[model samples]
Target: MIDETAEQLRERVAVELERARARTALLTDAVDDDDLIRQHSPLMSPLVWDLAHVGNQEELWLVRDVGGRDPVRHDIDELYDAFKHVRADRPQLPLLGPAEARGYVATVRDKVLDLLGGVPFEGRRLTTDGFAFGMIVQHEQQHDETMLATHQLRVGPAALNAPPPPPAGARVAGEVLVPGGPFTMGTSTEAWALDNERPAHVVDVPAFFIDAACVTNREYARFIAEGGYSQPRWWSEDGWRHRMEADLTAPMHWQRDGDGWAYTRFGRTEPVNPDEPVVHVCCYEAQAYAAWAGKRLPTEAEWEKAARFDPATGRSRRYPWGDESPSAHRANLGQRHLAPAPAGAYPDGASPLGVHQLIGDVWEWTSSDFVGYPGFAAFPYREYSEVFFGPKYKVLRGGSFGTDAAACRGTFRNWDFPIRRQIFSGFRCARDAEPV
Candidate 1:
């Protein structure tokens, strides 16, 4: 970032900001006004709330903070204040309707782009290397993904469409060996990295074997076939209790289709694709499945090392493939596909240790709680990550198909309650290495 010239950074920031807005448009425009306003599920916000909130954030951060311009809509600040309101209760508030939300975001975007055309890229921490702009872009992309999940939950016809991901390329190795050693975790220098991913640190992990790609639907089906879910031995006390209470017999949106199973994706029901990585399984489910298969979920540090470490050079990469940016050919990101590409679809995207599909497809559950690393400090604000740091949330590494490249990186961190299943999540298994 420091090496890039002012013009280069501006162009990059503009492109990212535009990309995020374009996606927001696609997700919201596909649904009607009523659909946007309806609360599809208690767990997610109404589409209209998301639309206006995106604009509110842009106005608060860019239009006011970095640009030093007056508030664009100060009166509506509390209406969209996420901390003040909860997701289930947001619809009862007087949120901007569909058309009004669209207009507000458009107005904010126009001002932001105008400011970007001349805003200096140096001085303040927020402005340095255009980090604030990057933060806004990531925040918007994250919401866009949330909106995509809402579409999945909405009760209606298929409101969105996209060609399926590519088929599997070759017979990828089932698992790969990651030799035990200390490697760098998180980021210290990567531009646009969020507050929690800062102040890079080293973690010494024991040698372990991890799935080369994510655990595929075909692989997960085996666990189901063997009556994995019915057994309590594979499940922990909490997971067993939750399973009994929820009566969760299968992954969300899955149902018995005669002798096999079918899955509902964005309102379209079809036979589950055997070769694609299994999604919508909560951390508890993943943990149970791993136990049934005689394996365990990787630790957060192990997941990062497998995705970033290069044994030959003893240096971590910015992504699984290399330092290059993500693209259609490299990863299944940015809503380019409605579903995960078949396992082993992107051969070139494999990490140095031959781990495939680590970048995009599904967020892999890890066996670690969300907490700050040593020497951690809250920068700018504490709400973004600090508030959620505890044993309540488990870490999820990697990114999903709905995730945008701007919001994901090898060092990026995502955490959620272990019981959440509606989000597009999946897992891979790991096992201790043999005696040295």
Candidate 2:
């Protein structure tokens, strides 16, 4: 017999699973069969692949892993195994067509839901606290964000729409000083945090001054105007090589037009808004821009300390503002707006140190490379985080407007190749604080 607490958790997990499926439908429904199959870039899988991959992961964890059931479609496992197939190669595989993929996912979800009704939440670590269900929800939501990226890359009229974000209010311009101290870095208590965020550890961070808000297009444009790309001093040797090879002059989707800048977003080209936070920039570009501006990108530790540390209590809150869940007033999240709110928006979401937009708007690139915490151990699978721990990828913290609550916790870690500019990424600058 399940206790009241366990029953409540089960119900919540069921609802979340359905909600994820609903969101997936919205993304897939917006485009037609042809759109689903079309690969927007070599960097991303076709939308239909992501659609079915979501279902495959759900079935793998919920039905086979948790429920101990026979594989519904064991033959197609390799086709959907993310590690087994690369994004560029997926199109050549014997992929299920749009209608067939939808049907497969629908059938898998129905079975998973039925299993959830009776699956005990206490038998194993994965089942305990409904962690498996939560993981699946986060997985689907992650894919949803990926699909949204594909939408942005697709060339056509806008197929998705949302109202513009609220206007920015008056914001004090300056840096927030975070005192040198020890603070908790990761979360061991978050019920659904991924393996990468597990085994909470303490970090000793030095005093530093970080930007109060994300770097705006106006600010980044300064770097471009000063011939930041042509100047090799600001960029690392590798970054300089990549920059010269790609011949990049501005952020992705941007072009110079008669002493002004124009950018494409969600299939619409318009004048770049100088006040808005710049998005779609890679870590290398961010780093170079920081160097040109006489600043540096904050380390992941510093970024977390700024976002989560409460100086008065010396405790890390679940978010920058507090332990409260995110909402429209607190942050611009869950794809409510296609673009970031203007800089200085979300005053209420400011951290204890008066840092704004740390939890949303765009994924902030950090100076840290992707690595596991002390005493870290993979759960349920190693391919998720263990395989990616290295210098090849840089870490990105803070969730983006496209990020969902399930995957947007303060301890959550995102990593990508430094050359990846297709993601909704941006960065703020930091500097060493002067000693008293």
Return the top candidate by lDDT. Answer: 1
User: Can you tell me which runs of candidate 2 are displaced by over 4 Å?
Assistant: 1-4
In order, the Cα lDDT scores of the candidates are 0.92, 0.91
**Model 2 residue 92 lDDT?**
95
In model 1, which regions exceed 4 Å deviation? none
Note the residue pairs that clash in candidate 2. none
Candidate 1 all-Cα RMSD: 1.0
Lowest-scoring 10 consecutive residues by lDDT in candidate 1? 1-10
TM-score of 2: 0.98
Question: Candidate 2 on 1-436: residue-level lDDT in tens?
Answer: 1234877988888888887888899899999999999998999999999999999998888989898888888888999999998999999999999999999999998889888889887868998889899899999999999999999999888999999887887574679999998999899888888899988899999999999999999999988999998999999998899998988889999988789899999989899999889999989899999999889999999999999999999999889999888899989888889998887779898988899989888999999999999999998799999999999999999989899877897898999999999999999999999888
lDDT of 1 at 176: 97
Query: Residue 132 CA error for candidate 2 (Å)?
Result: 0.3
